[model samples]
Target: MEKMILNYKEEELIGKIASVDTGTAIAFIPDDKKMSELQINQLIAVNSPRAGTHIIGMVVKMSRRLDETILQNDIDDKKNDDNVVLPSNAIKLVFVGELRDKEGIKVNVFKRNVTALPNIQSSCFRIDGDKLTKLMECISTIAANAVTPLSLGKYFIDENSTAYIDGDKLFQRHAAIVGSTGSGKSYCVAKLIEQMAELKSVNAVLFDIHGEYSDESFKRDGITQLKIAAPNDLETANKLDKGILMVPYWLLNYEEMQALLLDRSDSNAPNQAMQLSKQIMTAKKSIVKGTEYESKITLDSPIAYDLNAVLQELHKLDTAKEQGARGEKAGPFNGKLTRFNQRLENKMSDKRVGFMFSLTNEEQELDWLQKFCRQLMGTSKFNNGGIKVIDFSEVPSDILPLVIGLVARIIFSVQQWSAKEKRHPIALLCDEAHLYVEQNESIDAVSAIGLKSFERIAKEGRKYGVSLVIISQRPCEVNKTVLSQCNNFISLRLTNVEDQNTIKRLLPDNLGNIADNLALLDIGEAIVVGDATLLPSRIKVEEPKIKPQSNTVQFWQVWGKNDSTQDLDTAVENIIKQSKSE
Candidate 1:
């Protein structure tokens, strides 16, 4: 008891609690006090009867209101006295956690439930300088012992101490990094990748939707950059080369293939789908003959087959004629499979989708799937390959979701089928997730197939040693199921009200007020929350050693000093070719 009193006496008391509510305590300030000393979001402590513990709260709002009578008098009189003071001045603080000692070690441990609210008129003291630094150090020590701590930035209240989150939980539980454009979302991702790169065996695949991360500046020993095969590269791409990614059509399951070619509006869609599935199964079976997996392979197996054979079979079905009651009549599938065949042929012939449909005939080899799996899910520590960043910039937007879904489905399937002991944990960093994972209300069969693939992975990926780091600028646009599955969030400044509200709704009720500063935050600063962080904190993310190519252009400076840069003709040609610009 004496020690408690001594500690409280040594601290500078700010005010006394005037009232206590559910999770907030109101404190009245004395007129003589300098209000400028107190800051919103600053941590403070309330004296508790407990022997060695104090109730910690965060200052969220402060207001000074004059009485009606005082305001009327001042308005009636020509002049008002400057010395007069308002009577209703108070500060509201939300109880965050408790600062206490355990086993002789003092730390700021977060707890959602509070045993007791501060007593009315209890003294409040500001936490600053040495006291704040010591508390942070204790928390840091606790986090260090509990999990693999990753240093993010300095704590908002005590800049002298660094902030950290559990690196293990951050990935294992899944995470999202969200912010508006130019608010450092990409930088935060770069920072995380940089930290993970320090680990010798870390395997992360970043789907570069816009090809922004393929910069030569990020080239390093551990970083292996690759791109989806373009229309022109299909003929020359070597089957064994890992630098060019070609996802054969054989990898897509029945539903996914339907998504790409099945047009629900057609009256014979059902017949077309049935014939397509049957032909694909037969095609796969024919290719696996004499192979070890021949007896085990299923219709959905990732076994390459001759797409042309399937087309030929469909053509025969559409043209077949069988004897009827009187004379030769059309077959059951005659003309029904014609439109489906046309759609399939069109998709296969389209050069833009070469990555999915234009693989060399060597893809039919029995070892093709095995080799691609090793190239994708393999780790640098064991296989001398790591950190594959596949650029999807050349993919058309209409089928972007389906294409990305194919890759994710493949990765998940590989991870799921591998022996538990032999599985290498992989993290899929999805940049611009909203583009593919956004909600689609059209009820189209095509959209639902892609949506379901990602939804399943979001729900069950963690148990199979697969993690996702979804990066997006519009939290509202991203799928709710995917966002809800994420247990950690590193949210930068979000100016949109809907986006802000989406993030706010995800927070616990007790700390909902903390999100009020979301729009007010500066660039590179984010509110870190969820299971990975010991406490919900605002941290300034450190700049990555090698940044991504996401920096905003300096329009004003560029316009001030412009020069002749003649490259539009080549750009137009590249656009027409539907390929990357040289």
Candidate 2:
């Protein structure tokens, strides 16, 4: 006689394991009524010989195949028959983990790795209703024992119980949240932020590419909001309103500046880049002339320098003539520096980038970098959570990658250089990551440089207490390098075949069926998998108290309203200004 599980009952019997593979098992259901109730993603248990232990699997595929002999007879007769035959239901399950009762203890423990596969003819039971609720609660306790769990929402299988993820594992290992438009991607992110905000010293930075997260969303007691200085905010730029942001040009290293101002397509680009490098070093040296850093500053140092002085020297080089054997010969850089000069002038004069080129005198102080670091990493009354939401809505698409990468690099560098004892961990929530972190066949010099910075972070940021939360709608468009580095994934509905395929490729070979219904997921429903989760589970994310401003528009409701003509002219003017919604 088989020793029954603690809660095992005859009524709980669903079927028997017909076959067992490395990562999946096929269960045969003889009862039509029992088969009807079986649903995809539902959890089931297969009894093992070990006491208080069972193999856990999730339903991934279900089908009813007609008896071949019966079907062949009707086909051969080519005539209608009155007899009816019930088809056998085949339930395919993806093995997730092994659930066992700890020795001498009543508690059940769930391990992601399976120690044994179910043998053929093993009895399988449906773990729904009360069974499922109890199982999830037990798993939640297991998660809590390892580390503080992050309560994202409720499990799809057991809505009565909350879904918990290992918070430490989730961040220590990078994470990715992906879904289609209107699939509640932003809502999930907002909810996570809301939870982190509850901590006394939360440290995170959300790269708000479209200004999606609003003040209302983060109006919580420990959250802070900040916006980048737009074109219109230039004249009044200051830290007073806690509204201004300065990504000073001096902060960019030689390679970053080259990406911003050097056009490699030009035949003379090489010569020009060389000249620009020298001039930057000259300007940096000039700034530290009488300071202690005079002997220590490198060309890539983040020290303040006069852009005008560099431009003046470049102008002289472009017009200088050298006395040679051929009397009054043009300088080697005379004609080569013209185009480079124009590019630099345009970037410096562009009002849209005032945040980089135009900064207050205070922002140029030697200790400004220290203050900036504190603002981003400190949890003081003036700065909430050390959580900064930097809005990049007005940033141009062409330079978006470089600018965002700059900020990430700064954060990583600060943490890297800090003394290990004094280092504080920080998480970067990159919204709209695909726009800047995509893999491409051909890329411009600037984008190549930007890509390098992010790739480095993805590969090594973990060692320095820096983590990334890559958020995107199109997983296919995101860089595989970054995606591969992530050990946790929160995937919502994805309708595109290509997008679905991308997620499938990342998942383990045995769990391919697990992502088969990605396109069919309900809004806010997601399959949470990887290191953070105790077991691969489907979750229905809870709605945030204050919604993000980027929620999908109700097209039907808006179509019912008429547009106002009074503001039409102003709207057109704003569009032309390139600062319309700034």
lDDT of each: 0.79, 0.81
Candidate 1 on 458-520: residue-level lDDT in tens?
999998999988899999988889889998989999999999999888777777788888999
Q: What is the lDDT of residue 493 in candidate 1?
A: 99
Off by over 4 Å in 1: 1-6, 31-35, 65-87, 104-116, 144-148, 239-242, 382-385
Compare the candidates by lDDT and give the number of the best one. 2
- Cα-based lDDT at residue 191, candidate 1: 81
Error of 1 at 249 (Å): 0.6
TM-score to native of every candidate shown: 0.91, 0.91
List runs of model 2 lying over 4 Å from the truth.
1-6, 65-88, 104-106, 144-149, 380-382, 561-566, 580-582
Model 1 earns a TM-score of 0.91
Alpha-carbon RMSD of each model: 5.5, 5.2
Candidate 1 Cα lDDT to native:
0.79
Task: Name the lDDT value of residue 386 in candidate 1.
Answer: 75
